[model samples]
Target: IDRLAPSVVTAALDAAGQGTAETRYLVAGAGTMASLAVRTLVERGVAPERIMLTNRTYQRAAEFVATFGVGAVRWESLDVELQAADVLISCTGATGVVFDRDRIARATQDGRPLTLVDLALPRDIAADVTSLPNATLIDMQVLAERAADSEVVSDVAAVRAIVDGEVGTFLAAKSASRVTPTVVALRGMAVEIVQSETERLEARLGDLSDVQRAEIRRALRRVSDKLLHQPTVRVQQLVDGPAGLTYADALADLFALDPSAVDRVSAVGEGATND
Candidate 1:
């Protein structure tokens, strides 16, 4: 992401009708994209003082300066920084408009053309600013479409594929774990019935010897175990495959299992994996 910012600045400069050597950059956020944009500019040989970095809070801008050497970080006099900039990238997460029409109008009044890129979701820069005489506005949608049309840059596509694969595996494991509680609950129910039936038989046949009662109880347990063996093993096997989650969900619904118990089991599994 940092590697693309210099080329973006170059394009933004050309669109604003500004010369390369004379350009001054203003970064209007301290987030990932904003920091990457600053790093990109500096790596391309722009002087630190020539880059103006600002955040919503002064401390965040200061934190950037501490981490990435010194730069023109400002929390106040935003208009002055905007006025001097040939290109500005706004990547703040603010919900409402940061740069409205009137602010852009006042900043660009000095006859210098300005290029503004809005990287926020709801947009930090207003769309109406495009109507201003020599000003240019670039939003996230334009940049994304342009990026999609371009060829893969330096094995980035391969890296993205790897990340996607890792995410899929993680999701599969999480889905498989959902059946754990249901399996445990089913076995517990089986054991409870076995104990209850054993007691009833002992009470009805009161004169039976202890050894015969013990053997009969063992036989009952074996029967229950045999009945469950195939299903439990099959469920485990099915849970590892792509269709695993569906089978797990079906098992829970068919058994009338407690949703809260399933969720608690899943949460515990997630926390253990996280650790």
Candidate 2:
């Protein structure tokens, strides 16, 4: 979106018969695209002080004043700013047309030329602005028509495939992380149970050798692991599906797993990262 702004500005200015001359600019947004537009203008030798930023929220516009070294306008003062500006680059992403013919006519009543660049989907500038002698409107349709015959240099499909793969990997890893604590807690429970049972068995069979005791403990652990294997794997798979964390919650509830145990596991992981 940022990269597209320079082309939009260049084409709009050319259509208005206005070249890249020293002129006042009113950027009708403080969003990412607006910030990029301001940066692009500054890079093209337009003084930062020549640009002004405005948004629906006055505070948002004010926040960027220091960063961009540009003046900020209150939302209510948009009309006042529009009148003073020679070029208006509007990308507010608002629902309705921000400036209609009447507003533009009033702003240009003094015979000042105003070039309006509407880069929004539901265009910020009204189509009727073209009717005014002093006002020029350049919208998305104009840009699209200009680029209709342009050549494609990048492999769009390959880029989309890479994006899709990265998004999928991110989501799967996020799902796995949510269920990891429960899995760890379940295994910890199994270990405790196996150890307790093994100790009881050893005490009852005092005649057994150390080798026999160790074998009994190993056998108990194997039995516990086998009993747990399916549910642990299934819970993880279910979380990645539509069920999400519902299955993880169910597993914890059914086993009456201690919530603190999960918290402890998470805390230990955080401590390890800090180390």
Candidate 3:
């Protein structure tokens, strides 16, 4: 999704030509999504110094500049950036409109055409923003619809297939992940039993040969793997099917496992890997 968004942003810039070194851009958010958008613009040939970032939180603006190696200002200082910017991309997750008609009109009164791209879910740019002279507002839904219409029929079909395949893969991976903790716990129990029995036998026999102990350990591990094999495969198959989520929930419930524990594990794993 991150990759796709940047590609889309790049294409938009190519079409709009508003992020060149000569053209200034303002990104009005320092969140992860906004950072990505800004990063994309910079990577696509917009000079870092030419781009200005503004976030509601001063610290967030600072953090964004530090993280993405860009120039940023607090929202309170937006007017300075607004006067010079040719393009504005707003990805702030604000509940209400961040830019109203009056604010946009004020920016345009300075004599520069303003293009605003609002990527917020509830919309950061008010509906009246576009009504202002020299102001053009583009939203995600509009861009998505445009992309959808412009997409080739075959390409659209291919994308749908890819989405379905990816959805299936994610579900299967999730389902497999769901059972992992239970499997680990069960294996831990088995290993404990084996160790206890080995200790008892060693005590009774005075001392068992090292080779015999090693063989017993390997055998116990093999037995555990064999016991777990079918269920693991079945669980993965269930995850690939239509009832995958339901089956995963049932399995987790049946094993008395915490679903949130699985989610936490997945989140940790994702954090560990850069992707």
Candidate 4:
């Protein structure tokens, strides 16, 4: 929050026509958020000499002077410092309002433009301060209300789209995995049939040479592979749809495959995954 919230202050300053290099910042706290706001101001081109730091405890304000190279004002001098400031960013952990409307009106009686930012919970600046002339207030509630209309919403929509696409891809891959055991069992049955036929042919045709027997075995295996290729590919493609598991069951029934064979293949696949 220390990093993100300060950007709102910069936006408010810009909207108020408080040029970074010339604007005077009166930061009314010595906490982490306040220190970061100072750093933000300097990084955006505000002169360190023009920024002032103050806290309820005077020593707390003095401690940060070496780090930020800005003037330190005691708590008693806050109003005096406020009159000279172009922007006031108050984020003190105060129990109540630090600057009421009347006080702000007095500070801006000269009619100079002032931007007040209240980042505290109970609010360091009163809500009615906006009624004062030549003063604009941006608080937490204002930031929240404007957020949905900001450019950040478009970025958020883009991120959500990417996440949705990834989830769909993962689900499709998981669905494809469910029919793997069936495919493996069918392929195993084809291999056993090819081996048995090749052995039977060799025994019946004893006069045939080794080269002729090898050629016959290769041709039979190629025919089996070509016939099985389209069905296996189609089954895998359909498994990502609504009736995925039903297609696997239909394949098993049509082939008259033994249940034990598919179960054995499934067990082996599971063991490999665990390993």
| RMSD of candidates 1 onward, in order | 8.5, 8.2, 8.6, 16.5
- Over all chains combined, what TM-score does candidate 1 have? 0.49
Cα lDDT tens digits, model 2, 87-198, are 8989896767888888999999999998888866557889988989998777766665665435211222233355468668978988887788888998999898998899
- Candidate 1 local lDDT, 109-155, one digit each (tens): 98788888776555799999999996888875455455543542332
Candidate 1 worst ten-residue window by lDDT: 151-160
Q: Please list the residue runs of candidate 4 whose C-alpha ends up more than 4 Å from where it truly belongs after superposition.
A: 1-20, 149-275
Model 4 lDDT per residue over 1-275, tens place: 33355555555455445465777889999887787778877877778899899999989999878887888999998889999998898988776788999999989999998898876655789999888879999876676556655554453345346546866786887798788889989998999999999999999988898899989899989988998899999999999889999999999998988889999988998898899
Task: Name the regions of candidate 2 deviating beyond 4 angstroms.
Answer: 1-40, 50-157, 266-275
Which pairs of residues clash in candidate 4, taking residues 3 or more apart in a chain or in different chains? none
Would you give me the overall lDDT of model 1?
0.74
Model 3 C-alpha lDDT per residue in residues 14-82, reported as the tens digit of each score: 445544457788888877668777778766767777777888888888886777677878778897778
Task: Sort the predicted structures by TM-score, highest score first.
Answer: 2, 4, 3, 1
Better of 2 and 4 by lDDT: 4
lDDT of 3 at 151: 50
Say which candidate scores most in TM-score: 2
Q: Where does candidate 1 clash, by residue pair?
A: none
The residue pairs in collision within model 3 are none
Per-candidate TM equals 0.49, 0.54, 0.51, 0.51
lDDT of each: 0.74, 0.80, 0.70, 0.82
